[model samples]
Target chain A: MPETFDSPPRFDTVLIANRGEIATRIQKACRELGLKTVVVYSEADRQAPYGKTADSALCIGPSSAAKSYLNKDALLLAARLTGAGAIHPGYGFLSENAAFADAVEKAGLAFIGPSASSIEAMGDKISAKRAMIAAGVPCVPGPDTALSDDPAAVERLALEIGYPVIIKAAGGGGGRGMRVVPEAGLLQEAVALTREEARQAFGSPSLYMEKFLQHPRHIEIQVLCDTHGNAVWLGHRDCSMQRRHQKVVEEAPAPGISPDVIRPVGRACVEACRQIGYQGVGTFEFLYEDGAFYFIEMNTRLQVEHPVTEMTSGIDIVQAQIKVAQGDPLELAQADVKCEGHAFECRINAENPDTFLPSAGVITSLALPEGMGIRVDTHIHAGYKVPPYYDSLIAKLIVHAPTRAEAMARMREALAGTRVDGISTNIPFLRALFEDSAFTRGETDIHYLEQWLKQRRAP
Target chain B: MSAIDFSDPATIAFLTEALTAAGASGLEISWPGGRLRIVIATGNEAGVDVSVTPRPAPTAQPLVVVKAPMAGHFYPGSPSRQAATDRLPSVLAADILGFLRVGPLLLPLCAGRAGILTKQLAEPDALVGFGDPLFEIEPQS
Candidate 1:
């Protein structure tokens, strides 16, 4: 199998097939590369700031995401109408969709991500675990195969993996379609419910069982690869500050973890990328528990938390992904890469702070901190209306400093300086979280945030 | 090849199923025998809203205007009806005035009501969105 393409990709204009901050982010990257940008928007996002800033923006469909962003034909037609040479599925939506990538390539347009085959391989959890194990990356204690229909066999496998096993849908991601069984008594019912839920949710009943680490922290290795088989693991991120499996805060260099400990795991991730013939940017998500890394899944797209790694590594990941899409070999080798400083990112969601219900309306007043190592990636401004039809993420607040404690202090200052009015934001919640002694100290597990919230709510 | 009898209820149901399977909003097939326009209003479900625009959203502009029923490339005149463009401002009959070239199929744009096409809002061969204003009509005095 060929790993590299010798010639440059024949494309001048890049179409961003996403909305909000990511779309704005992709446009900035394309502009830096001297490429024209075509942004497609749904009717709800007609007033979105990113659309106006792009070289060309077209309304593809109505307010619904189905009729617009997820509408493959509409997106393709929008690209054709605007004479776009390539499509960048920034994140979510069709970013991890294999068929969309294949269709874009088959339509003679470059898909600014990895190949469809790679996405397919990693999209399925069982196949991804197998690939990771083959590449010497650590995996959880379980078989790297789909569960069979035999109920007795399923129970035996659960017993083998031990109690408190997690049954995950092979096709599920973003923390959906899974159930944790505490003991053998509830195994069958858990499997049946998860199987039915998986079929209804991810359109696949195929599932895999694994030992559910009770207190594992979410660790991700950011990797960038090119068509020439060159790949580099930028650094590690500790996204342990999560609520309901949704990461609310992220930081680079992952607190007290030693380089000697993470270096091999990073290399393993890079090796997995090479084995899969991956191109563009991807994240190898893992669960860190008991001083070991367990491969969970690979996100074949630029992540929302990519900026923290960029700040630490002194690299422009979005631009690098775009250049790789242009058939450009990775300019920086593994040795050339250096991750310094510590960075933290807080997702500013447009939701009620206490209740966390989505609060979408016009931002009548707004204020954000601006200074050294303080960067805010947001599409909303004063008077910008937040739509109810999409993700609640309104902005990403990132800060960097020489040390983890300094970065925490900077984030504290950044959160204090940040303000949004006329609609609710999670700034209050984030401010409270930053003040928490355990999070400030770092190395908190994934379950820490929920526990803290529970403690706070307790009378 | 024999033209498909789209009027058949079984055929419509089958096509509807195919559309659902393909995750398409609707299907419009025109053959020598008949024409079928199936618009599936996927309500409260995970599907696109393929609501067939039977006519344009009438504006206060008392003049009846012609609008696109769906998305396609706008061509001012048809290959068989070249004289249609020349008859601008002419009291056209309830017939084909222009055509929306949707790939190989050219769906006819009907005046639906006899009126004078005062202005062509869209340029020839311009890729237009669904329900986009195509032609403005002025009723006869």
Candidate 2:
């Protein structure tokens, strides 16, 4: 049943402030909602299929991301020019930028995500930890405050938290602006270097310390919330396959974890959202080790690896986010949420299989998998030019099956059927990873991919 | 050679804006006694600045297609004047060829150099995006 909304729809048209596959994803959702779509692109993405098919496509700036996708003023101006009443900032770029969200709301446009205050609350690592603890979310053992400048005091704090602590920037994410110290000797130097880096990179030298888990597996809970204080936890995901803190592959209902162990954590994440008055979709990322979950951070936007959860949980997260932005109450309760089958998502990047350098060129030929349980979300086609200006993720290959082993087999088949010509891709690397005995047995840690790559490189 | 007064503050301003919009690393022109360069710095989100001893012209010329610096509504001329909007194929001299309106702001679209405006690619009052070709110009050789 559709809940009543007292106000008229907040937006009749949505301006997609993103590019590539995610932009294509959002446009499809808007089409289903019967809302007019406006897609913005950088000059390099002039030939993007989403832009071509959108109700109105506009190039917001030049090829440089800073001048285009990251340019907040340009995005707002584009929305105004196109008479778009809302803007959906897909993952990456300015998706989590609190200032952009505030500016969007100030411009009388829906931002299609949480309010600026909620984003700010979760953006700061220390504040986020405090919020999580308040909501009964388990966090890594550490103080919920910024580190002091006093060297002696800092050393004492480190001693209290024990060595092997990680120093992180308050305003940083995507695995940058952090330093992991394995012992006391390197603590001060690491702190100094990281603080300076944080100041230079994130515009603030404020740093915090936490116990660095040595063998934690990356896990996260997907959550959806409405403005009416109703929220639901969709399910959990295992994104342990990482290279340099970037998730290369992800799966749903993380293998081998009992539902009893994760259910409380999922409930806590939903509680955190409600406590902060969160709206729209978000991900509560964690580091799990020894059957325990530690809250890390909350990505206050739609995640790149959301498809695996969508396949298992059977929800159109992007469309739900839009509906929540339009002031609609959540249509489903926690009881309606169900994780049916296992799923896997491999991020197909346009890069060298070994060196991982970005490969940008026109696709001379293309072949992607088809058939039941195999879905490839991509915006590329034959003759499509992979732009060198942005993230190298060109496509996502997702497969679902009733069991994890069957899903692995399905993914292997899909990967075998895939072919991209005229440019290098990580297809070879993904195929090789799928065959790894440890990965196949679902017994890999967050550091497993790097260790695997290191072993592969050893003579 | 052409009489492009690179020293004119208006020309420098126009060139800097154009360089930033085009994502050009920088622009350098040299002639008899002077030289001018406008660099669009990669850091700090494309901050463009030019220090000029400004005097001069060109070694070569090519057709230039002026595109929008950012997204906005494209106007062929001062909208208040009815006849100016329809006038096309006119000769331009490093001057304002059109205007791009964003709300109350009307950003002048300059040609950057002397040329014959051969075509207007965008419709009057049309919402044009960045890098949308607005005018085609054949520069004087």
TM-scores of all predicted structures: 0.84, 0.87
| Model 1 chain A lDDT-worst window of ten | A1-10
**TM-score of B chain for each model?**
0.50, 0.49
Question: On residues A1-459, what C-alpha lDDT tens digit does candidate 1 reach at each position?
Answer: 335554545799999999998898888889998999988888789888887888887778887898899999988988877889999999989999999999999898999999889899999999999999999999999999999999999999998889999999999988999899999999899999999999999999999999999999899999999888899999999999999989999999898889999999999999988887889999999999989999999999999999999999999999999889888889999999899999999999999988899998999999999999899998989999999999999999999999999999999999999999999999999999999998887899999999999999899
Candidate 2, residue B44: the lDDT equals: 18
* lDDT of the candidates, in the order given: 0.88, 0.90
Among all candidates shown, the one with the greatest TM-score: 2
Candidate 2 backbone collisions, by pair? none
DockQ of each: 0.16, 0.61
